[model samples]
Target: MSIIVRDFQPADAEAAAETKRAAIPYLVLTPELVAWQVTHAPGNQRHRLLVAEVDGQVVGSASTGIFAESSKPGQAFVNLSVAPDARGRGAGTALLTTAEGYLTGLGASTAYAWVLDDEASTGFAQRHGYQRSRSSYFSRLDLAAIALPSLPPLPEGARLRTAADFADDPRPLYDLDVEAAADEPGDVDSDAMNYEDWLALYWHRPDLDRDLTSVVVMDGMAVAFSVAQTDRRGRYWSGMTGTRRAYRNRGLAKQAKADSLRRARLAGCSEAFTGNDAENAPMLAINGWFGYQVAAREWRYLRNLTD
Candidate 1:
């Protein structure tokens, strides 16, 4: 069967999401979120979601985009996923090749991808001229079954607030995210953070549950926050958890995450999932404190488009 790779259409949302779920089960993915990503992607990103099909059945997909948020130009990303049953049908190769072409067409000089820490996947990446870099871990917490840690009392001047409190203006939360993200360990350091992009990428996400997102406000300003992204299926994803730079080391991050988890559990979310860069030991320790168990690991891989 020949593989046909083409741009993803709106009707392919379900199929693409299913393929991604099969390839990365720990990821909290939904069709609506998949479609939203494609439509809401910032113009500078030059985002394209490609799908590979055999006999008219979508079996693989790739999300390729320029790194618009990075101060460094010519950087891009490509994440590929294939249905389990379609692994050996050349779908992966087709999608990867097509995605690389697409990225280069957008003037990308470098492309980064996440390859599952498995022999086949890593081998494929290496065979395609990709070099391994740092890794990231995915963890899952069974909110329905785990005993969430009892949060410590907030220190003076600190109070818990839901993200809903910022419904009128989320600029403070955006500021918190930018500061926290700067310290996040990753290959590409994002030095450019924009408010409009933030609103589109995170605030407007259909899955973001503002009521379940916890914010630690100190002196009437957001000092720490945990963003909760979930769907109707009782599953929750920790979109992000961070404490503003000046507010670090005060356990506000833990408090914010704990509050979010507690509320998520109470809301009937069965499980919670999150990802952390392997070098982010503090966040890992915090998640460990919450009894989050490691589920999977993926290695970062990079390819030089000019090579």
Candidate 2:
């Protein structure tokens, strides 16, 4: 079977989404999200989604781009995934080769990819000359079967709301996300404060579950929020959970996450997943308290493009 890599076409969206979901079950993804990403990826990001086809069927995909918002310039990313049944074929290598060339052409000096902590997966990266760096864990909880903790009563002057409550103006949410994103421990820091950009990519994202997303309101402002996303199958994921700097040290992030998870369970979600940097002790503690256990680990692998 000949494996060929090519740019994503509209007709390939569903197959690409399916390939990704099959390869990485923890992520919340859909065809619409794939299409939107191809269209609206920031100009500087040099984003390109590639698919690998074997005998006219798509079996693998890669999301490649320059990390435009990272504080460190010249950093790029390429994450490739192949359907389990399609794994031993050369699709993964084909996809990675195409992605690396694309990012290098866009002036990226360093390329990074997340490698699953498995023998075969790690071996692939090592063979490709990628060196491992920090690791992160994926955790899941039985949302429908697990008992949720009683939500602690909101402090006086504080209340709970949803992202929909800020439809008229989501600037406060944007500000909170920017602050929290910067604090997130990662090789690259993201600055996602652009309102129009956020609305187009995040607010309007097809997978974003607005109703289940919980926000803590203080003085009628969004101080802390847990962004939620769900797939067509009702699998819920915590896209992000963050609190403003002034609101840190309070249990607000935990509260928002718990509230969202409870709502997801009520809505018939069977499983919920989230990821945390190994260094993020607070978030890990919160997930552990909610019965989330480590499902898998992925390490960041980096290689200098020029080398």
Candidate 3:
């Protein structure tokens, strides 16, 4: 069988998305979202999606790009996935090598990738000189069946509202997102400034559930929020949960998350998943309090692109 790896075309979005779903089940992926990512990713992101084909059937995919949002320069990411049924082939290695070369040429000095916490995946990364780093687990809760925490009454002078409530002006949402992202723990930085981009890429994205995305408003400003995403099948995921610095220690984050989760359950969503960096002790503690258990783990592996 002739095998080839090449840049992803618009036509390949569906197959590439399917490959990603097979490789990383925890991620809530859809063809429309995949295509939107390709079309809306900032030019600075240096984003490129690639596919591996064997005898004309796509069997693997890789997302290679610079972490432009990151404050640090020279940092990039190359994540590759091979279909479970197609793993024996060289598609994975081919995709990885090609993606690495592409990012390296783009001036990336260090590239990080996520590999499943399994023997074969870990072995592949180790053999490629990638060092394993912190690992994070994906957890899922039965939103429809599980008993959600009793949401506390909105604190005095504070009110809960959906993202949709700010339809006329999303700047508050943007500000909240930026502040929360700045506090998030991760290898790469995330600086979200362009409101138009966030609108196109996030607000208008197919998965974002604005109705279920709860925000805490105190007086006249948004202070805390929990972004929610629901799949085509009603499966829910906590896209992000954060509280602004000025409002921290007030338990607002917990309130927003609880309200969002409760809303998701009422919306017929059975499963709710969320991810947390292992180093994020506060968020982890909050999720644990909500009875979210670890379902799967992924380790970040980094390789010096120049080497």
Model 3: residue 217 alpha-carbon error in angstroms: 0.5
Off by over 4 Å in 3: 191-197
TM-score, model 1 to reference: 0.99
| lDDT comparing candidate 1 with the true structure | 0.92
TM-scores of the candidates in the order shown:
0.99, 0.96, 0.95
Judge candidate 3 at residue 303 and give its lDDT. 91
Model 3 C-alpha lDDT per residue in residues 180-263, reported as the tens digit of each score: 888788777687446766676578888899999999999789999999988757778888899989899889999999988888
**lDDT of each residue in 1-307, candidate 2, tens digit only:** 7888999999999999988888888877889889889998777677899999999999999999977667677899999999989998789889998899888888899999998898888899999989999999999998877887775777788888998888788888887788888899998878634666667657888888888999999976788999999985778888899998888888898889988888887887899999899999989998999899899999999998998
Error of 3 at 95 (Å): 0.6
Clashing pairs in 2: none
Report the lDDT of model 1 for residue 108.
91
Order the numbered candidates by lDDT, best leading.
1, 2, 3
How many pairs collide in each candidate, listed in order? Answer: 0, 0, 0
Off by over 4 Å in 1: none
Q: Total clashes, candidate 3?
A: 0
